[model samples]
Target: MSVFMISQLLIVIAICFDLMSFQFKQKRMIVTCLSVSVLLTSIHFALLAQWTAAALMLLAAVRYIVTIFSYSKRLMFLFLAANLVLTVVTFGGLTSLFSFAGGSLQTIASFSKSDQRLRQIMMVGISFWLVNHVLAGSPMAVMMESLFIGSNLVGYYRFYGMKLSS
Candidate 1:
């Protein structure tokens, strides 16, 4: 549950929201929102040497660019297909691209003899990471008032009881 690992997980959830937004034609507003969020995340992680997660966000930038490009249907399909293939490859860690290896439990175990203060710091890092994820990443999974989820529902709250707790 390292901060890096948590943000990485949130990236997946955010990307899912991006995918669904595209699928449901949520317009550039959604893309704009997600893209800006990713930008901020990339910047945040870059500051922390969480290079893997930052690189993922950079890749997200490329995807956003492609999404906004001027292109024919054929070209758009190509971009989409290429983006999907690259996304699967990167997100799957097919070649260790942006791999989230910080919180594999094995990681925490390796510090069994480390200083108590270090262990405490690690725990705090993980918790902060997890909270950052839930706050910044959960919005994409919801579609406001979609009927299947109920006409008056507020997406994440209804689906996962996930409020930002900010």
Candidate 2:
């Protein structure tokens, strides 16, 4: 599979792990998913030649180890901080997509209300695919789509300043 496909797969699996955790409220499964996600991240870094993968993997491993051992809030805080850094850095370039994608959020949010765990998975998975798309697609394409649709979800709307909601 392509690196993009592999990354999206990792993202789906990661969100699945998180969804499972939300359903059962178990930390271990989430950590396991985090481990797999981190491993994929390392490979992604090698593929992309970014230096953050090592640090991410280390943080993931540490979070897994501590969570497995049933750690204290301090450790959890550390994990949360690492997650914060990962969240912003990983999604930085795609923020424009999210900022624009907000309009479709009502529809998406309905799913979350239908079932809380399902909501998280959909949100994470779609965001992952979109982030991958925005980052990997041609800059020209991304910009054109974003401007055309007033959102990153270009194909979902009509042409000429029209929208699904109108």
Candidate 3:
């Protein structure tokens, strides 16, 4: 298969992981699946030469893995700063800005103690990512982000017995 096709396949796998993460109610299982998703996403972005997305996803993977053990404000601040630096370094005008915003939201979401809040914040991030991927012409990524929005909405419903209006 072509390299691009392979990368797209990898993105699909990552999307599956992300979808699984949303389905799990347990914190550890959710974060573990998210970490795997991030790892695969990072590899896919790198293969596509989307360095900023790759860096952010790698940072996300690290953050998920670390937080599984313990969480602290210090770690959040450190990772946020690192993510911002990477975003600036790999800036590509508006597209990079979208990634920055999405990554920032996800970073903040990582610190949330409530699963509902995390999923809510992630929905916003995925929206931004959807735009980014569309602008980059990443068809699979765009589709996945769109599905992520729907999946997150379903997650909120499952968690709270209603849509998260907030």
Top model by TM-score, which number?
A: 3
The TM-score ranking, best first, is: 3, 2, 1
Better of 1 and 2 by TM-score: 2
Deviation of model 1 at 47, angstroms: 1.2
**lDDT of each residue in 4-90, candidate 1, tens digit only:** 565455545444443343222233433454465456556545544545445655555554444444324454345435434544554
Which portions of model 2 miss their true places by more than 4 Å? 1-26, 80-133, 136-166
In candidate 1, list every pair of residues with a backbone clash: none
What local lDDT does model 2 show for residue 41? 45
Alpha carbon deviation, residue 35, candidate 3 (Å): 0.9
Each prediction's Cα RMSD?
Answer: 16.7, 11.4, 1.5
Question: Please, what are the lDDT tens digits per residue for candidate 3 over residues 1-166?
Answer: 9878988999899889878888878767888988998888888888888888888989999998887776688888998899899998987678788888888888888777777888878888888888888887789888778877777777778887776545
Each candidate's number of clashing pairs is 0, 0, 0
